[model samples]
Target: MSVTLAVNCYERTYRQVLAPGYFPAIEQMNARTFEQVIALINNVGDPREAQDRAAALVDCGEITGFEFVSDWVPAALQHWRLGHRHFRRRPYLLDYGLVMPLVSSSEYILGWDAETVLEEPADWVSPSLDLLGSDSRVLHASLNWPPARPQDAGVEGDAVARVGDFLLSWGFSDQVFLISRKNMLATDMKTFSPAAIARHAPHPYTFEFRMESYQRASRKVRATYEPVRYRTNLQIDGVLDRTGKSQYEGFRTEALHRVEYHITRQLPSRLGPRWARNASISQARGTKQG
Candidate 1:
């Protein structure tokens, strides 16, 4: 018999809490630009005709280059808006969710930042396999895309190798420090749990990445580097359990056998250590209580 997967569609928003001041300034600029573009869209007698005229102007070379301040904003916004609308209405709906199971295990990729690799002393840098590998100094990757399924059995070393290769191909990580896996599910699909969703919600602020700049030393010069820290807030708006017929009125029966991946980067990490630590801790505490 075909297996059933309880697919959850989530909306994720990344809020940058701690970063260089310039980052927020740039965000404000972008927001203002977006508002101007929306005003232009509203001013047109016919938005479609305006888009057609813009395209024709481009084809005739009347509009040759973009001016970030004004010229290209309308076209870019309209293009993205229309393209996303078209994608949502398509039959395949792969962008909406996964149709086949892409990941069967939960794993994390850990390593040192490039700055540490290039500048820090070898002894000062700790490998991820060490007891203190989970230290704050280590870089932990966030796996948000292609949401992973819960593995019921311990992941083998070979399986980790394969998953590591997959992550590399997708530009997720360059190095793997350690692989941590757990058998959390007892069956293929579990009943929808609101408690589970609530438990997975993000905390106020978490480290995202560190920015660094380096200057090489010459014959009469000295080497120097500067580091800037950044933290992120993951806001989970809501979740839709598409597997239930009653909950999802238009649920497709054919979708039962297929697992949805929810390719949109909007889906938060369900597997990696950075995000799943709270859930794992709760599970451990629950096991002790039992």
Candidate 2:
């Protein structure tokens, strides 16, 4: 089965808290991570769209190429003009939440958070896929929260709970997960409508939309936790600002300090990074066509 890595990187909102100088460093870190992930995708031989067409859209030292997913743009922009009190100024539901799942041809899609850095090269989901057996439909990571019965659960498990014929998880916004195309398409079909997003602004966090998707799709969905461990530099304690309030109250704005890429030796990757490799290929193709 094919796999597509759908990652969300919203730099505009993150800039709110990070110092002006930190953006350059953050851009470097993102480029490095993008390069590493591309290498891994090539090594694993997972089929994905050739990154050529989308690469040119990458901002200077930034992975903004994927921002083309804009199904939610109309509604979001209208909200912006009307001065809606959404937490995030710019949201990724158009790309990450709405568009990716609904349109991807990959049999399995991995949702990755851009702020995270992987310490080593690893095929993160292969083992979990094997163990969960062919019958399993979803594989996810754990959040730092105690599992409890969902408030509206009709059936409950120690770590799993079902509600209204659907399953709900406290996985902390699904930072990482492997989901089946069938489940995603099912959820897209059942809960969210293209018209809805076009007509009205949904929650900017996108959590409620995601949970509702999970609920409608849970009938055929059986999910398992991933087995790999990740290293993140997210400082949980003392992250609050001067007023004893978290700098990122509803969103994250921490600088990309202590990233794995910063500590590792830089190498000449075959694909380079930040969608540039594909852009080069696209440029060459255009030249040949001309």
Candidate 3:
């Protein structure tokens, strides 16, 4: 299979939260995480040696290409200024992510966030791709479903079952999945329509769009899920200390708190009418809103 990995690298957006005065420290953290991901990609094989076998999917011919997608500097700045009001709140979600398969020549594409690193030698993508072999009914399959907070585990499971046809999770913790160009087109992944973007403004950048698309697709297709191989460590963006729980975890927690406290509580008002600024206000409450 001609498989490609499309990674969404939003370095500019990573540092967008830092005001001009906070550039020195914030830039360093951003650069560090960026370099760390690059290094992880390089060291994917070295740590385990793969028993002298092909270590990376790249080496084994499972993933034939790597496309690093990001917005241009001008566009990034405008989007930052425009915030979440213009098109989609998280433009990178659709711009750098969902659009990958549509633009690629490869038959299969593994969409991933830059923060997600590969630590295992298993050909996760190829196996998932093989599972869908010649089965046009299978629309997409999740590569991993990382655990959510212990307390909310039950709620999460219920939500997954509720939307089993169109899976949803607490954002990034469960988004990694493998998809085909055919499925992408079938789900209308190319153009993120303005009306749809407005309706999903609150959680625009997450997998909700894809899930909804799948749900809306022909009823004959099926979606599959798999246990996560790992939680996939996060690169703490702006913290200097790496001795304990990641700063990324801290950042993610805070963001989720605000989402729960602000967005969820006020979804009616937050996503009121046609992409209101109230939602923008909720989205811009302190810590980075990636």
Number of the top-ranking candidate, with lDDT as the measure: 3
lDDT (Cα, tens digit) per residue for candidate 2, span 98-212: 4455435566666655444444435545543443234332333222222323463211221233322223332224445556655555453224322122112223235333443
Each model's lDDT comes to 0.20, 0.34, 0.38
- Pairs clashing in candidate 1? 98-260, 98-261
Clashes of each: 2, 0, 0
Candidate 1 accuracy as lDDT: 0.20
* lDDT, model 2, position 234: 43
State each model's C-alpha RMSD to the native.
Answer: 20.1, 18.9, 14.3
**Cα error, candidate 1, residue 155 (Å):** 14
Q: Give a tens-digit lDDT track for model 3, residues 1-290.
A: 76554444333322221122222232232222111111012113132342122224344433333333332323533433433333343444444443454446767755554344433424445445555574443455553444444454422341322122233222222235566766665453332322223334434444455444333222222233333343444434322132243556457556655654554435553442122212222222222111
lDDT minimum window of 10 residues, candidate 1: 210-219
Q: Which stretches of candidate 1 lie over 4 Å from their true place?
A: 1-74, 77-84, 87-231, 239-290
State every prediction's TM-score relative to the real structure.
0.20, 0.42, 0.45
